[model samples]
Target: MDEAARRHNEKMKRIKAARDRMMQDKTEEKGLIIVHTGAGKGKSSSGFGMIMRCIAHRMPCAVVQFIKGTWQTGERQLLEEKFADECRFFVSGEGFTWETQDRDRDIAAARHGWELAKAQIRDPAIRFVLLDEINIALRYDYLDIEEVVDVLLTEKPPMTHVCLTGRNAKQELIEAADLVTEMSLIKHPFRDGIKAQQGVEF
Candidate 1:
């Protein structure tokens, strides 16, 4: 081999050895509480990606949308059609908080969504549960954070993973989660007066 190629192979060998050692230490597998939160977009999109992963594995999954219920989404339609036997979907919000503009109504909707989520969390058959936009509901004080955390910590099935997605996830919830991903916004097209498109934003 050329000198450059030999050096490259040596570097990759060390990297592979380190990765193997790390993998050897990760011997346990169980349900994870995953949180996707930040000011940037794609939180719900990432949650849906997990649902797709569960569907690929033929594992039962459920989704409880706490906000953004103004219209049907492409992901919702596709998942319902393709994974009908493995997925349960619910949309409890009337619309965004600004659209609804009713605190009492928003609270009721959030509670309803939480009820659906709790049911899915407790179901052993459901290996994955996505609480879409739940962080926003919690941020608006529409749902009790303590109550949600209690159910996530105590009531969820041992082998069932749960994902909560939205902006402004509470510190308490972040602390309780096993994995957390925050999408930071450096730039977005919406700032340039661009409107949300059909498939891209929805």
Candidate 2:
């Protein structure tokens, strides 16, 4: 074969081998919990990416958005229009902590949202559950840490992937999470007195 053809055949072979390996590791109803945390942005964006990937594979997902209640983003718009039936998105009525400043109200809303969020854990239909901004609620003690941990540990279905995102994740949640990512903020437009843009920060 010519040089280009030889390289193409080699690439095909590698792809086939990788596909076989993935098939070998595939299982029915197994689930994973992913936690994305830190003092940086993009936590919800990362979760949204995973949701999109799951939707691409025809898998169901549920999202509980905390703190980020009012602002609308492109992901929300797309999910609303395109994947309306594939995923569930709930926005908490209580806004950010600094804005609300009502501990009782925040805690109450967190508890109410947890009722819905926990259902996704045991739901075999939902392949992925994204708990957006959960870490922030946990950090602020808006939700009961032990109760949340218990539900996560005991209720998740097999083959399900859970994604949690927010800043300042508790050490206990990190210990329980299968995959944890800490996003560090090197710079942001907020530092330069640029207010949160509609598409970017929302």
CA RMSD of each candidate after superposition? 1.0, 3.7
Model 2 segments more than 4 A misplaced: 1-30
- Deviation from native of the Cα of residue 123 in model 1, angstroms: 0.9
Q: Estimate the TM-score of every prediction.
A: 0.97, 0.83
Tens digits of per-residue lDDT for model 2, 1-202: 9999999999999999999999986664447778898888888888998999999999989888887776676787788888889998887746787787788888888877788898877788988999888888888887888888888888787678989899888989989888899999999988899997776776
Clashing pairs in 2: 29-158, 29-159, 30-158, 30-159, 30-160, 31-159, 31-160
lDDT of each: 0.91, 0.84
Please write out the lDDT profile of model 1 over residues 1-202, one tens digit for every residue: 9999999999999999999999999999889999999988889888888898888898999999989888889988887788778899899998889998899999999999988888889988889999999998999888989999999999988888999999999999999999999999989998899998988877
Counting clashing residue pairs in each candidate, in order, gives 0, 7
